[model samples]
Target: MADETNNPDLEVNAASVSDGAYTLIIADFSDTDMAWEAYETLKSVEDGRSVEIEGVIVVRRTTEGRLEIQKATDHSTKSGLKWGVVGGIALGVIFPPSILGSAAVAGGAGAIVGKLRQRHHNHELEQKLENAITPGHSGLLALVSDPGEIKIRKALERAETIVESTLEQVEADDIKAAAKEVQGAHA
Candidate 1:
């Protein structure tokens, strides 16, 4: 799941980003719903050109201690199709496959989803997420590229969400090895 929107004309007010990645952990949600609400709010802001959202995943620890991960989908396409009668450009054209592919593999295909998959395959980050968000709690893990910090902060604040931890200028390999020190754990 991805935003798929690559509007070059879309204005983004942010400082020049260095060549690297960043990880933001939004935690302390009262429930999964609240976390999703915050995610939706952030997505809406991303849609409106407030910030550059690269990838997002929602993690929820169920009452029975199961970890659930939710990825972002092309909601704009669904919404446009549902309201196609209103007469507007199809979202597909606005967000072409080529653009989405380029964005996904901007740094490298392995650097984006690969890291997330590594996190899932190993139990380190998953365990940390589970521990941070106990049963009945929820959190969000977002990989943003040169995000507009002010806009993102305002959007989260408007949604009444608080960020628990943030690691900037993060390396993809470092993220992939977050749980490497611990062995014999599987997702």
Candidate 2:
């Protein structure tokens, strides 16, 4: 949901980004196995470019064609506890509730999970994410910062399709608020 008014189209490259604290990269793999492999490879990705990978997650379509989070990590953040992309509600907003499609009702969290779709721009973002990862394909979402964006594309060479979006602090704060609401209800 990177302010659809300015850039209506989702871009494959985010070289235009400047001064922003974060760049969100979503890479779709040819197959589910490839995604898992890419996820492993990501851990060792370093090119001296200083592109910090803040958080990352690998998701694949389950047997029923629903998105399933296979692995997620926040890496370096927080005081001690690792931060995760999904640990907040960013990933939740990327995939619509229907795509989650199962006994997702884990009490109040389930109801709050659906709140992402309620936002207009999030729906468009969800549709884009859905389109990128077709049946049997998997997606790797990364929240990165600093320069050398190319390092990410190179590391994700196996990605069949890659899209990058700008995530400003304002939008991130909104996501955090949504996550807190969901957690508060769950608690």
Candidate 3:
């Protein structure tokens, strides 16, 4: 969900059999710049350490035939006008203040900005998915890992729940691998 991966047109794939490594497939289905982003967020639960839960981001083709490029700038913009102001003010420091200000401002004002950005990004992503979706073209994001049956199942279930409406369900094996070919073509 974080904008670390700019892949706007994401397709998540999580099958029970992919072992324990999360695999992300990014397909540039549009003529525009690859609009996709992906990154993992690690959390420390009560346990001593947690498994490195990974997130996969994939670009899918839409019915409208436009690549859903969730721009990085868009994400930052959604973060907030306040952060922009703070960032600008901090920039005035022209030194360590810029770096420190970023962290501090992001923590306070940036929090609101992050939430807004994420909310709008998700909304836009959904809209683009709806618009680009065609009968047979869809971008995909799959998170697969041999973490464990339980983990794998949970991941797959999560993906299924999110992708059910936007895309036609298919076995991971059945999901044709046009991503690489498509990406190469676009590149």
lDDT of 3: 0.27
| Tens digit per residue, CA lDDT, model 3, 57-156 | 2333444343321212211112122212222212111112212222322213333343333432333334333432232232333322223334332333
Ranking by lDDT: 2, 1, 3
Better of 2 and 3 by lDDT: 2
lDDT (0 to 1) per candidate? 0.38, 0.56, 0.27
- Candidate achieving higher lDDT, 1 or 2: 2
Off by over 4 Å in 2: 1-21, 46-49, 71-88, 101-121, 146-148, 174-187
Using lDDT as the measure, which candidate wins?
2
Query: Judged by TM-score, which candidate is best?
Result: 2
Stretches of model 3 off by over 4 angstroms after superposition: 1-50, 58-60, 64-149, 158-187
List pairs with backbone clashes in candidate 1.
none
| Clash tally, candidates in order | 0, 1, 32
lDDT of 2 by residue, 21-63 (tens): 6666777776877776666666567333455565567777665
Cα displacement (angstroms), candidate 3, residue 9, comes to 24
Instruction: Assess every candidate by TM-score.
Output: 0.44, 0.64, 0.23
What would the per-residue lDDT of candidate 1 be over residues 1-187, giving only the tens digit for each residue?
A: 1112532322222222224455433444656676677677766776424465544545555676444444344232111211111001111111122222222221122333444443334333333333454565565545444444665654444222333322334433343233221111221
